[model samples]
Target: MAHTAGGTALTPAMKIAIAVIGVLVVAGIVVIAMLNTAGRDGAEAPPSSAPTTAVAPPTTPGPLPGATPTTGSEVPPPTAAPGTGLPPLAAAEPLVAAPLPKSGSRDGGLVAGFPTSVAEPMEDSDVVSTSIATENTAMQVSLVSSTTTALDEIRAHYRALWTSLGLREQPGDDSTMAFTGEFESLTLNVRTTGTGNMYTIFGVLRTE
Candidate 1:
């Protein structure tokens, strides 16, 4: 039998051919849709024109929390404690006295620059040794003599001499006594030399 959609008759081979052409058209339409979907997935979208927020850096540095601020412009100077400070020097102006003399005494006689204020051992005393030491700022005189004068007279003579010069007598036994004055100190030592009375005098005079 022959079938026709319009006026022409359709053969078996012609019908099969028409079915194949219809299948081919459907396949082409499916391929086109799949290609469009793949293109959309692969391509990047255009950037947005909307504004965005951003963080900014600080303008000035500051100390951390819990930090303490220092006080005042400077520290006060240290003060010397009472009695613990250096001993008073010669009891005079400027307070600090010069160093002691270092010269030695060898032969006998009176040393040069012996202070007239410090009286000699005695007119009859036999001199054992004498020395004179001088410095730019000070002078030291020392005398050693052996005398037959009475112990009381010898002591009294020096005691009166030291008192006249306004020196304060320091504590001492019968053997030694030191008289302290302004700018100087005088130490007189007396002892029995077995044969006679021996006396030694040390005078330190500070000049200017």
Candidate 2:
């Protein structure tokens, strides 16, 4: 038998057992080194893609710079009324101021609806022309005559007739007299023409 340095004698079985333990130790060391190397390299390497999620920015929309915010004080303009086609302030104006239509007379004839009894040619006066018409809801009657009667006489004649007809006298000069009442208006004028004094009677009545 061969004696070892520590005084134990070497045997085949003991050597084989020792050799198996050395192989196992080397295999364990190699596994530990590989695990350490993998951990270090993974820690040092860059990521293949961006971080899955980073700090996100604000997501709400805000007003633009210098834009004004609503304050609930806005208003719209008012609409105007539709037109009526009459003159301005036409309703408020006097009836005499209203526009009238034109009229021309025919010789010595009475128009339909003329009040011949009240406003015909004076006694002994020759009727030269007469006219009657309607305009703007009013009635107009006119008479022209040649009279030898003086202005004073004619005035007295019509004044009595007007008084009987319930017509009140309006302002007048020596040449013209005006009377108005009961929605009726009249003017009598005596003018000196080529032949003689011409007496003209013009009247307007409210047709209403």
The lDDT per prediction is 0.75, 0.78
lDDT of 2 by residue, 1-208 (tens): 7777888887999999999999999999999999999999999998798657777767965666777866643465688887897776323222333344454457876655566755878877888888877777677889888878887888888888977777889999989999987668989999877767789899887644
Q: What is the lDDT of residue 19 in candidate 2?
A: 100
What's the C-alpha lDDT at position 147 in model 2? 78
Candidate 2 residue-wise lDDT at 72 = 47
Q: Going through the candidates in order, what is the number of backbone clashes in each?
A: 0, 0
- Model 2 spans with C-alpha error above 4 angstroms: 1-105
Best by TM-score: 1
lDDT of 1 by residue, 116-173 (tens): 5565658898888888687777777888889999777888899998787677899989
